[model samples]
Target: MLIDTHVHLNVQAFDEDRHEVIQRARENGISHMINVGFNRETIPSSIALAEQYDFIYSTVGWHPTDAKDMTPDDLEWIESLCRHEKVVAIGEIGLDYYWDTSPKDVQARVFREQIRLARKLGMPIVIHNRDAHHDVVQILREEKAAEVGGVMHCYSGSWETAKMCLDMNFYISFGGPVTFKNAKQPKEVLEKVPLDRLLIETDAPYLAPHPYRGKRNESSYVRLVAETAAQIKGISLEELAGITSRNAISIFGIK
Candidate 1:
């Protein structure tokens, strides 16, 4: 069965037909999904979604863009949420220089605190780095994030960056952008990244793959990502799906 390593089902985009979307994904062979909480407000909502769905799990932490609003109490709240039964990781966190919503220093501080939290709780992480590769890699190393290895969600970095993350025992996740016709870098990274170090996601209601690009994404569309990787790695689609699913189970400790 396939697993979407990162999704945002808690967002309002799926409110209208969330149940049907999930059912369709199950029918399409998606057995599990990891819903990521992006900020202080989304954590409870994300956890709620996980509790409601047997196959859904969640990750809680502030996204880089939302880091500006985080406070001491917010960190404590997130720490508390990490103790929830269905919360498996601390993330959708990291650096995003592409947007100026949060100051760089604030994002780094929040990112480091969350990394420490994940380590303290013995949970993995879900990183979101955008155009801040150097600092992100440096911070992860300095923070000893390898202790709570995680996935670099929607990875859009170079092979060198991916190799560094892999060396730190982190899984490299590819999303819808990998399927775009002009996505040369991700395609190269997909080919170079060892299958064992790979995970696939849709980041639903966000980046839908080609043909489905510009439309709302869903877990079922993860098949397109698997197909893309298969073509790049010269493997069968079934083999790609099986390996990626196994990798997800291994990383997230999902049953």
Candidate 2:
């Protein structure tokens, strides 16, 4: 079975046929999916999605891009939401220099605060890092994020950076980019990351894998990521799926 460790099923893109999309994923062997809420607005939607679907879980936090609109009270509200049983982690949080939506300092402060909140709640985190890799790594270390281990969702970094996160006990997740013909960095990281520390995701409604690139992605396409990892590690598809699913279970505490 496959577990899509990161997905945005609550996004508007899936509004018309969300249920069908989920059913298709299940039919394709995706047993579980973690829907991430990256801002205050989406938090309730994420929780509702998780409540509506047995296999869907939610993670609530402010994405770096949404940091500009957040206030201290908003952070407190997010902390309150984390108490939900269906909420598995505190994230899609971290730094994102790829977009200048929020100032770097503000993003960093919000990210650190969210990390601290996750630690206080004794929950893991789902980190989203972009061009701010170095700063993200530094902040995570300073915050001692190792206490509440999590996954670096849709990881796109060098082997050295991945090792830094692994040392902090973060699982390395790969998405569509891993299957891109020109994705040398992610491919290299995939090979370097140990099977036990690796997880697969589609970041659905976003990063579609090869043959489906530039199209709307879904949890069902996670199989392509598994197949790609199998080829990279010289393992059978079944073995790859088993290992990665086990890794997902370990990280998310899902059955």
Top candidate, metric lDDT: 2
TM-score of each: 0.98, 0.98
TM-score of predicted structure 2: 0.98
Question: How many steric overlaps are in each model, in order?
Answer: 0, 0
lDDT per residue for candidate 1 within 146-201, as digits (tens), equals 99899999999999999999998899999999999999999999999998988999
**For candidate 2, lDDT tens digit of each residue in 141-205?**
99999999899999998899999999998999999989999999899889999999999999989
Over 4 Å off in model 1, which ranges? none
State the C-alpha lDDT per candidate. Answer: 0.92, 0.93
Q: Quote the positional error of residue 146 for candidate 1 in Å.
A: 0.9
Lowest lDDT block of 10, candidate 1:
36-45
Model 1 steric clash pairs: none
